[model samples]
Target: MNDFGSLLSQPVAQLGASIFTLGHVLAVTLIGLALVIAIPVMAMRRAARAQAQIAEEAASRARLAEERMAEIMRAQAEMQGRIGTIAEVFGSRQAELTKALSERLDGMTSRLGHSITEQTKSTHENLAKLQERLAVIDTAQNNIQSLAGQVVQLQHILSNKQTRGAFGQSRMEAIVADGLPHGAYEFQATLSNGNRPDCLVRMPNGAPDLVIDAKFPLESFNAIRAAAEEGGPEAQKIAAQAFRRDIEVHIKAIADKYLITGETQETAFMFVPSESIFAEIHENFEALVQRAHRARIVIVSPSLLMLSIQVIQAVLKDARMREQAHLIQGEVSRLMEDVGRLDERVRKLQGHFLQANRDIDLILTSSEKVTRRGAKIEALELGEPAPTAPESRATATDTAAHGRLRLHVVEDGE
Candidate 1:
């Protein structure tokens, strides 16, 4: 049991001890609890003051951000307005340039078409006029060719040599007929002297007269034209030369026939129609001309023949003057013969007048005797006077004596 009681007191002791310890422990614990609570209140008050400063700074930053966003929106609106104004101005300028180009192109096309139409019309008019002129030129050319052919035919007929010589002779005769009387010319005359010549000129006095002949040579003169006809063969050429020699023989024959002696012994003539032919004969055959002249043959051209005819006319005129002088001489001889016959008759008349005077004296003597006888007888017979016998007889005797003529010398008139 003690043990039990000790245990209980001990327990009390232990409990008291425990209670005191507990009280001590409780006081210490309370003091530690007050220190913990006061430290928590001081730390909590410092944390609330820091939280108030952080909230005021956050509100100031939000106000600054809102002002910056408003500035950006205003800038975007100004840029959009400028872009719309530039687009409207560019559209108006493009429409004006396109309308000006279209008007200029239309006007140029109409001008080009008008110029081409006018040029085509002018070219057609020029072509029609040229064709008309060509037709007129062709007609004129054909007429000219026909005229040329007719002229050539006329020239061929005129060149025949024999016909040409006859033409010249006829022309010469026609000209000479105008200047003189027809009786003065003798064409193809035959003279009284038994010579035939081309012409025989008569002088005033009746006598044999001058002679003239026409000489015409053909072949020698024809040879001068050999170039006109080509003599093809040698034999033909030789025959032409022989023909020339025959012409020379005919010239010599004409010279012999015309030249002969006449009353005056004058030269004879040979007449050639051309002067050019005369010149050719003289130049080529000088010896033949000299021989002919010595034979009293005179070669004469047309000009020289005319001069010779004038000289013959002058000689005929002088012959007529001499014939008039001979007639006057015969009349003077007859007048001298009549004067010789008148002188012989005057001497015979003087002898007859003397014989008549003697007869009258004898008659008077017989009458005286008769008176004596009568007186003797009258003694026987008475005598008386007769009255009428004495007065009447005296008147008759005076009238007979007055009728007689007297002459001394005969003058030219008697």
Candidate 2:
């Protein structure tokens, strides 16, 4: 404290180190003047530029912020809408579930009657409806059982030889089930010569197709069946060889009937539905198939028929793919034409935008000219309006519309 007082008592210590000598003081004063005037002048200009940049950045950020806020509000609104929608769905589901219990569901559906009878209350009010539903269930159960019995009866009928022929007809359906859509395949088709082949396999070439005829020689088969019904082995050996002879004769009969000129191909097909019959022929009488082959008659099994169907399917697919390839080439050409038209439209649109910008610039220049005139008027006194004329003004709203419709009036000089 004593040292501070001594230091404080001196004028040079209190103020600074001393103004010192006159030349030293003058040099320090000059440096201070340079810092105060020149440095501040340069800094002030830089600060003004920085302030302007800050204002522009603030304006840009404000615009971006507004856009983000708008997007957020829209998202919030959409979310609220979705929440309302979900609430409605849940309310409806709850209402339905509640009604499912409270509502007396009576005879709404005959199909649902059984479930209702089992689940409903046993009260007197529900008893009549329940009894009605029970009656319906009884009737339906009986009908179903009867229908099942009928189905069994039908199956037994099909086990007979006459009904077995009908089985082969629906087996034709298995061939139709091949991917060869209905257009390519024909069934029970008649030949050109008044002969109806059982089924015809149309060739890839639309001419001279092969014919397949189903000939179930069931008479001999019936004889065999009868022999089995009676007992077995007693009579079939003599009649079995006779049955095999009948099969060979049937093959020859088909060749004789259908192998006419312009009617059937020399090499024709005889369709056999049962593989057991096929196996029996080849196992016992191996020469029969070979003899049929010698007659230019092929005995085709169901497996062979399905294979034929697949071959037709391949043909149909090939035809379709080839057609699609041609169509793709046509579509490519049409797409290129569309692209060219789109480019032309884009060029025209650019020209229109450029002309519109020029028109806007004309309006801006007219505005600047009016501002200059306004500034000139502000410098003059209000009493000096008598010496000066009013400044010219033009605005888009004030422009006179010159558009007029032309009408030609024909006058007759009578």
Candidate 3:
């Protein structure tokens, strides 16, 4: 501190005489004071201006922010109004959509219900038809079973010779009865030679009766079939020979018994009821058929016998028509005579009618003349002047002439 004061004392002593005048001292003090005051005032003014500028910027920002806030509020209010309107519209549209969907659903449900009902009814009808068809199939199955049993019975009947002969006889008789009229054929009729044939068909025109024999030799044919099936040529040949012999003998018996000279036909029928046996005979035994033909014994199947019966029926019908021809002609002649008598009666009636017509015409003329005279009498009025002598005479003469005309008409009518 002493060193610092000494340093200052030295400077003060050195300039004390020149530098320490009262005016210099006063000026230095005043300059120091002015610098101190001016620095603070300038700093205060700059701070105030900076604060005012900051306040202005803050006020401007606040105003801008308030405007932006007001705009935001208006936008929000407008958006809310638009949103409310959109909400109302959406609510109405949603209600309409719901109502439309309900209507569509109701309609769809009703249609679906009707369709289901119809489908159910159709399915039921189809089921009923299927049931009816199944019932028909069941009935057919039952019929087929019955037919199978009948076939077995037929096989049993065909096994025995006597039964087989009766079957053939029955079949032949059935064909005859179905084709020919009653009394045209007789079963088991005894011929003049004391031989009873199986059937006797009365031929037309007083011709001899046709004979049909029904017995067939089936045993030998069965044996031939069995031997053939057994696979031995020699056995089949033997069986075939036996069959041919049996057939020949049967044909000879039928020819001898049925072919009567004056009573029966020259050719006799040998009825074979089974078409298969007949076919087998014709196909495999041609010689036997030829032999039977030579013996005047025509071997006929059931179909051929039926055809023969039909021919005989035609012949009988023709003969009956021929027999009744004279009677028919007589009836026709009597009818024509009756028609001629009726024609003569009609001509007489027509003459009577013409006379009546002429009488009616005369009566009509008389009535017309009377009507004209009445009209003339009526025309002579009481108020007018009476007729003179000449007119009166003329009227009297006209009346007399009408009276004569009426008399002539009456006479003609009578």
The best candidate in terms of TM-score: 3
The model with the greatest lDDT is 3
Give RMSD to native, each candidate: 80.4, 34.1, 48.5
Residues 1-414 of candidate 2: C-alpha lDDT, one tens digit per residue: 877555545343223654444445556789999888998889999988877776666556556555655664565566557655765675676567447523422332332454345333333334454455456556555644544454454345434454333336566554543334545556677766666767666554444556776666766767876776785696877668778888888888878767776545668877777767667777877788899999888876665655565565556455544454455445545545545554555565556556556755764575566556545544544322232332111111112211110111111111
Per-prediction TM-score, please? 0.33, 0.38, 0.45
- Candidate 2: residue 205 lDDT (0-100): 43
Candidate 3 local lDDT, 1-414, one digit each (tens) = 987555444432235456444445556789999999999999999988977776666556556555655664565566557655765675676567557656765765666566556555655655565565456556555644544454454344334344333347788887787567678899999987788988999998889999999878778878988998985999999998999999999998888887989888899999887778889989999999999989999989876776687677667756665544544555456555545655555565555556556755765675576557556545644332245645445545555655665565455445
Candidate 1: Cα lDDT at 254: 57
Q: After superposing candidate 2 on the true structure, give the runs of residues whose Cα lies further than 4 Å from its correct spot.
A: 1-166, 177-180, 205-207, 225-234, 259-266, 332-414
Between prediction 1 and prediction 2, which has the larger TM-score? 2
Tell me the spans in candidate 3 whose CA falls farther than 4 Å from its real position: 1-167, 320-330, 355-414
User: Per-residue lDDT tens digits of candidate 1, residues 15-62?
Assistant: 533533344555678999999999989888876665555445444434
Q: How would you order the candidates by lDDT, starting with the best?
A: 3, 2, 1
Q: lDDT of candidate 1?
A: 0.48
Q: Rank the candidates by TM-score, best first.
A: 3, 2, 1
Quote the RMSD, in angstroms, for model 1. 80.4
Error of model 3, residue 117, in angstroms = 80
